[model samples]
Target chain A: MNRYIKLVNFEISRFIKLYFVLIAITVISQVTGTIMISSQYVNSASEAIYQHGVSIEQFITERGLMSMFQVTASLWFLGPIALCIAALIFYTFFIWYRDWFAKNTFIYRLLMLPTARINIYLAKATSIFLLVLGLVALQLFLIPLLSTILKWIVPVDLRLDMSVTELIDSFFYLQIILPQSFVEFLIYYGIGFMVVFIVFTAILFERSFRLKGILLGGVYGILSIAIFTMPFFIFIDYLYPIELLAVETVLGLIVAAMSIWVSHYLLTKKVMV
Target chain B: MIEIKEITKKFGRKKVLNGVSFTAEKGEITCIIGVNGVGKTTILNAIMNLTPVNSGQILINGEKIHKGSYENVTFIPDAMTMLPQMTISQAMEFMQDFYNTWNQKRASEILGFFKLKESDRISELSKGNKAKVNLLLGLAMDVDFILMDEPFSGIDIFSREQIAEVFTSHLIEDRGVIITTHEIGDIEHLIDKVVLLDQGVVLKEFNSEEMRETEGKSVVDVMREVFKA
Candidate 1:
């Protein structure tokens, strides 16, 4: 267990540089985005009330108060969020492949470690989990700060003050990041976790068998997704909503277990350095 | 004792190791000698379980090798295994973090002996120095057996001499070692045992000094006699 944590830290340290860059990109792009979007909204409001001879009430009724939702809706805002999502997705595969294909084969050292090989797999998974959580946490902290920036630019009458939760509720992706409840958080992230393992097992399949394994790995991934969602299609009309959630959770755990088992077997019996 | 019993391995359809077997007892330096691509590194990788075997078993101290086997054995592959961004000290810290077998005293000694700076990043080191660091990491471990694959390959003559000098010193004393190298002349006098391999099979295994005494043939002569035939 101690080794597991150390391995996780080691894995984190390897990518921490690129991770910092990712964080910096998010901060720069999003903050810049908030300032620009708010200034534009205020400029438009000014144009309506002062230049066009419209009443303040008319302008406010016409355009509504500038909330964080509008800022979040723009390409300036959504672009970085999309970029972060894409970056995290790309890292899921890069985390594994980087060790194998680096200047020196770090996978050799990892494989030859004195602890269970599963620790290596689990550590990499845990690192990815922590990275996703870290970015979410950053966004959580950034939301209030960004709202403050919006308030500084847009006048009180021209803007609507929103709590972080209210802001998140209005945006589709933020709700996914910061789920409304603990159970929802587990359900969403649990499926994400299983997909990460499925892909890991697929990678192991490829590592074990090379060319033929690539085909085998793709089939395995598709098959895992098929198994996880089978209950949804088969029992869609038969089960209650709560019962279906329970069934889906159980099925997801089973798929994750199977992936971990296959990964263990390959690492022990079939994988080559 | 480390035993390789009739181990066979195949890559796709080509046989890499065919019923190749040998044993190395503690406190002896055993050299696996063969021309390039004759399953030398494959055998070492098999013993360490870095790669799987098609059939047969490898035993350490009369038990099959497993995950825990790494605590008592270390494999120093030809290339550097430490990440390039890490300084030499950071790499040492990594090893010390993972393995209970790590010996800091010996590690420091080797660091000094090889003239490697603790602050030098692994990526910046010369090939010879990188190889030294690779060897240093393995040798600093207090394991019972050490497997090295072509440690001397691609090294400068002076560096190779320095590494050969290490074998003769007390650093590797009383430990089982299985080293594979095609360049036999460098450590010919240092190794105590020899396993001559060709075409994925062991042609001969003998005590080097005994062969030198009774058959009056050096390692090269024995290799010439076995491989040529």
Candidate 2:
């Protein structure tokens, strides 16, 4: 168990620098974006009301604060969110491949460790999980900071102060990131873990068999997705919405188990350093 | 005792190790010598279970080798096994963390003997120093057996001498070592047994001393005869 922790920490150390860069990119782009858009709204409103001799009430009523919020979310937040997701997905494969493709074959050392080989797999998975959660937590903290930036740029009278929850509910992606309830959060992140595991298993397949493994990995990935969602398609019409979710969750767990099992077998029996 | 019995391996349709078998007991150094493209490295990998074997068993002390069996063994491949970004100290700590058999005192001694500083990053080290670090990682472990694959393949003469010095040192005294190398000159005197491989088969397995005294032939002489035919 302690060895697994060390393995996890070792894995995390490899990518922690890149992770920080990702965070910095997210923080800089999103904050700058919020400030720029809010400043633009304030300047445009001032021009309409004062320079053009229009009423402040008419200006405020015409461009609703809700519209300002929507614009800010769409223009700035979405890009960073998408970028984070894409980077993480790329890293899921990179974490495994980097060890093999690096100047030194770090995979050899990892495979020869005096613990169960499954610990290596679990540790890498845990590190990816921790990274995703860390970024999620960072993004969650940024929401309030961004809201403050919006409040600072736009005057009190012109601003509509919405709670963080309200802001999250307003956007589709935000809702996915910061789900309404704990169960929803678990379900979302569980799926994320499943995706990471499936990709990891695919990479193991590729590594073990070389060119043939590439084809095998792709097929394995598709099969994993199918298995995870099999319950949904099979009982879509017969089951209630809640029952469907329950069955889907059960199937998802089974798929996760299978993915880990296949990965363990490959690592132990087939993988070559 | 380490017993590899009739191990067979293939990559695609090409057979790499065809029914290869050998044994290395504790307190002896076994050298697997063969030309390039032979199954030298693959044999070590198969022993460590780093690569799959199609048929046969690798037994350590009468039991089939398993994941937990690594506690008794360590492997140093031809290439650097540590991450390039890691400093010597970090790499040592990583080994210490994973293997309970890790001996920090011995590791530090080797570091001092090799004149490798703790702050040195693996990527910054020369090819020879990288090889030293790889050797240090394996030698520091208090295991019964150590497997080295082409440790002297690419390095300066000075580094090769330094690495060869390790063979005579007390560092490897009682351990069963299986080293794969075509260059047999460096540790020729240190090898107790030699297994000559060619075309995925073990052509001959003989005691080095017996070859020297009775057979009146050097490993190179035996190799010339084996490959000539």
Candidate 3:
């Protein structure tokens, strides 16, 4: 347990700087987006009412408030979020490859560490999990903060004033990230966690077998995806919706366990630096 | 004692190591001397399980090597193993975190001996300083066997001299060491046994003193006869 925690902390420290940069980018871009849209709304409203003698209600009806939904829709707002997600996904693979490709062959040291090689694998997987969770939590926290900025600029009559949950339900991607119920959250993120592990295992396979392992890893990944969705195709006619979800969750867990086992085998027996 | 028996390793279609076997006893230094690409580093990596072998077994103290058993052995590769972003202190802490056999006091002593500051970042260090840090990480570990691959390769003469001093120092006293190097002049006298390798095969394994007294031939003399290079 101590060794595992040490590995986790070590992995976290390696990417902490970049993680902070990701957060900074998200916050800055999102804030700038909110301010820009809010200023535009206010400017257009003032121009029409003062210059052309239009009513405030008409301006309010025409241009919506700087709500979370509105903030999320703009390219300035969504662009950074998209970049953050893409970067994190890229990092999932880069974290493992960096050790081998970086100067000085850090993989040799990591592989030779006196712990079970599985600890290294688990630690890396856990770090990615923590990073994703941290970023999500930050996004959740920022919604309210960015909402406050919107409220300050836009009048209450013009503002929509929707809660964070309502804004999440408004968008498909947001709903996927911020599920309404605990079970939904688990089902969604559980499959995500499984994907991270599968990718990690695939990387290990490639590292172990080189070019041949690349094809093998791709096959293994496809198999993992197929296995997770098997319950849907195989039991949809026989099972209820609740039962189907339960079965899918169980399958996801199974795939995660299998990926971990295969990763351990590759790390211990086949992986070379 | 450490024993490697019939270890074979292949990278793609090329056989890097084939039917290699050797031993390094306690309180002795075993050196694998060969030309570049002769499987010298691969042999050490196999012993540490850094690179998986295709066949055969490695025994430490008469038991097959297993997970969590690497504490008894340490490998100082030619490349820097610690993350380049890490400070010397953090790297030490990292070693301490993973290896139960890491000796903090010995690590501190080695730091002082090498004149390496704990705050020094690995990325900013000179090549010689980086090599010293690598040696420090290995020697500080309280292990029975130390496997080093080309520790003296591509360094200034001063750095080579400093690393050579480590062999005679109490840091490695009473510990079995297996080292591989193409440049053998630096450690020729310090090594107890020399294992001559050529293209993944062990050409000769003999005690240094016995080879010199009985055969009246130094390691270089044998290398010339073995490879005719």
Q: Pick the candidate with the highest TM-score.
A: 1
Q: Tell me the tens digit of each residue's lDDT in model 2 across A195-227.
A: 888888989999899899999999999998998
How good is the docking of model 2, by CAPRI class?
high
> What TM-score against the true fold does each predicted structure earn?
0.97, 0.97, 0.97
Rank candidates, DockQ, best first. 1, 2, 3
Stretch of 10 with least lDDT, candidate 2 chain B? B61-70
- List lDDT for all candidates, in order: 0.90, 0.87, 0.89
- Pairs that collide in candidate 3 are none
The deviation in Å at residue A8 for candidate 3 is 0.9
Least accurate stretch of 10 residues (summed lDDT) in model 3 chain A? A59-68
**Candidate 1: Cα lDDT at A2:** 92
Model 2 ranges with Cα > 4 A deviation: A66-68
Question: How does the DockQ of candidate 3 come out?
Answer: 0.81
Q: Candidate 3, residues B1-229: lDDT per residue as tens digits?
A: 8999999988888998899999899899999988868499888888888788999998999987776667888889889999888899999988888888999999999999999999999999999999999999999989888988888988899989999999998999899998888878868899999998888889989898888999899888888888774
What's model 3's lDDT at B181? Answer: 85
How many residue pairs clash in each candidate at the backbone level?
0, 0, 0
Candidates 1 onward: DockQ, in order: 0.87, 0.86, 0.81
Q: Evaluated with DockQ, which candidate comes out highest?
A: 1
Model 3: residues with Cα > 4 Å off, grouped in runs:
A64-66
How does chain B of model 3 score on TM-score? 0.96
Query: Who is ahead in TM-score, 1 or 3?
Result: 1
Interface RMSD, all candidates in order, equals 0.8, 1.1, 1.2
